[model samples]
Target: MLGKLKDLLFSASEADARAADHDDVAVAAAAVMVETATLDGTFDEDERASILGLLQRRFQLSDADARELLAEAEAEQQDTNELYAFTRAIKDHFDHDQRVEMVEMLWEVVYADGVAHDFETNLMRRVCGLLYVEDAESGAARKRVLDRLGLSS
Candidate 1:
């Protein structure tokens, strides 16, 4: 009976580890989005809504879940010392095109308030490089976002 109990405990510990890993991925992704939004030094309401909407749509999460995740992400981002903790998880989990899409989404957030800041642009460039997205692709994505926002180059 003791041996069986030990095995059960081991199995539960493995499950907990897996859950932690999954949470890490979700938190990392959320952190990336949150950090990108804060890059402009103006986390405006429109940008927040855009980020929440994207999270809800992408993760198939309800509004409450998305908000909770965003809150958790904000905390994690504040605690982290660098961007790699978030970018690495995204690079490992997402494909090239998906990363490009992420860049596009970030640009959308930057433009959501009807103004694009230099810091936001710089952050997007750095993030694109980290995500292994080519410069041309990143540029193209930015252009597409700008076009959608009806913003002139």
Candidate 2:
């Protein structure tokens, strides 16, 4: 798992290097969102829509582009059972504010179905830990998301 992540995150191979130049940030963000949406036993329509909307708004992509990114992210998420590499990549690529925004995006996905399952919460904790986002910052991000969505925490 670590090896695979290292390669994906840091490899200088031609293909990966090209991909890294293209939109590593988008791929990494989409991958994390995909993982969150699927962490629970099911990936319902609500979760799917939530992720699509988040992707569109965060990345400023058109519906078609966002859908494409979502599809790519889903495929990548399925290939890995561990998120350490993705989170690590995100940590290395994103600044502190961007990481906090990611946490907010995650919270949005978690509450999209009108519920936050244990597995989903656990995944958020792990992702934040790997990103080196402080607990207080993550908690604040969650709260902001919940309040914006009018959901109680």
lDDT of 1 by residue, 1-153 (tens): 999999999999999987787677677878877887787677888988988888887778899999999899999999985898788887887778888887787777778888878887888888888899988998898899889879997
RMSD of each: 2.8, 8.0
Candidate 2: give the clashing pairs.
Answer: none
Compared with the true structure, all predictions reach lDDT values of 0.83, 0.87
Model 1 regions more than 4 Å off? 1-22
TM-scores of the candidates in the order shown: 0.83, 0.84
Residue 18 CA displacement from its true place in model 1, Å: 5.9
Question: Model 2: per-residue lDDT, tens digit, 24-114?
Answer: 7788788999899888888899989999999889878899999999999888889987688678778887889988999999999999898
Scored by TM-score, the top model is: 2
For model 1, name the residue pairs that clash: none
Compared with the true structure, the alpha-carbon lDDT of candidate 1 equals 0.83
Q: Which 10 consecutive residues of model 2 have the lowest summed lDDT?
A: 13-22
Candidate 1: residue 70 Cα off by (Å): 0.4
